[model samples]
Target: MSQTVDDPEGRLVSMIMEANKYARFAAVCDKDGNILWNSHRNNVDNILTLDETKQSLRRAAETWKVRDTLAEKIGRGQYAIVGYEKIKRITVPLQNGHMLFVSIEGEKPEYIKDIMKIVDYVERNH
Candidate 1:
């Protein structure tokens, strides 16, 4: 039987970390870019300060707004990725109008495939 969850988003952040070895951080944020739950893998160093991270989330939310405007013609967006020198930031829209952010190590082409698998897992289990 399935177990009950008191904080699903927090649980989801933990699960996402377990699902991928390269995942450095995972967070669930509101449509307004407010983070509801988040987790960072132990021993991983965050390159951005807290303020920078918050700004990035807000920008991700704004980018989604633009995508929403185009959805009528191009269909809905699945996810967006921003590749930096050290890491790749991925943002996905949740069914409940929240956003999921995941950051993984950079410079690996295979990480994209891994992200696809994670997204599928989330769709099935979360």
Candidate 2:
């Protein structure tokens, strides 16, 4: 018998896909605010590139309309509600301490938190 293992990208897609199961959209970013990946409901992991993802992340990061304490925390790598609509953004530090800013479903912070932990764990162990 033979088995297969998911590569980093594969695992990343899987992790993101799982996150999208609850979040309207999920994405991972780097320390300097570059988007590593993004997934819609289908979780196909296609139709985008690293550069494109980074652009989206940058746009999302600069999209601050609220003057609350949480908005300030974003520049300093903190997790809180950011979007105005039903979307919530959570910026988290990954295993290597890189930041992953995610703007997902407002009612699904837990989904991002759960996948965030997994992303941290996988990268750390690898």
Best by TM-score: 1
Worst 10-residue lDDT window, candidate 1: 1-10
lDDT per residue for candidate 2 within 68-107, as digits (tens), equals 2354564544344556455666655444544455556556
Q: Any residue pairs clashing in model 1, and if so which?
A: none
Where model 1 places Cα greater than 4 Å from the true spot, the runs are: 1-6, 124-126
Error of 1 at 35 (Å): 0.5
Q: Give the TM-score of each candidate.
A: 0.85, 0.52
Candidate 2 residues lying further than 4 Å off, grouped into runs, are 1-10, 43-56, 59-80
User: Which residue pairs come into collision in candidate 2?
Assistant: none
| Full-model lDDT, candidate 2 | 0.53
Error of 1 at 53 (Å): 0.3
lDDT of candidate 2 at residue 91, scale 0 to 100: 58
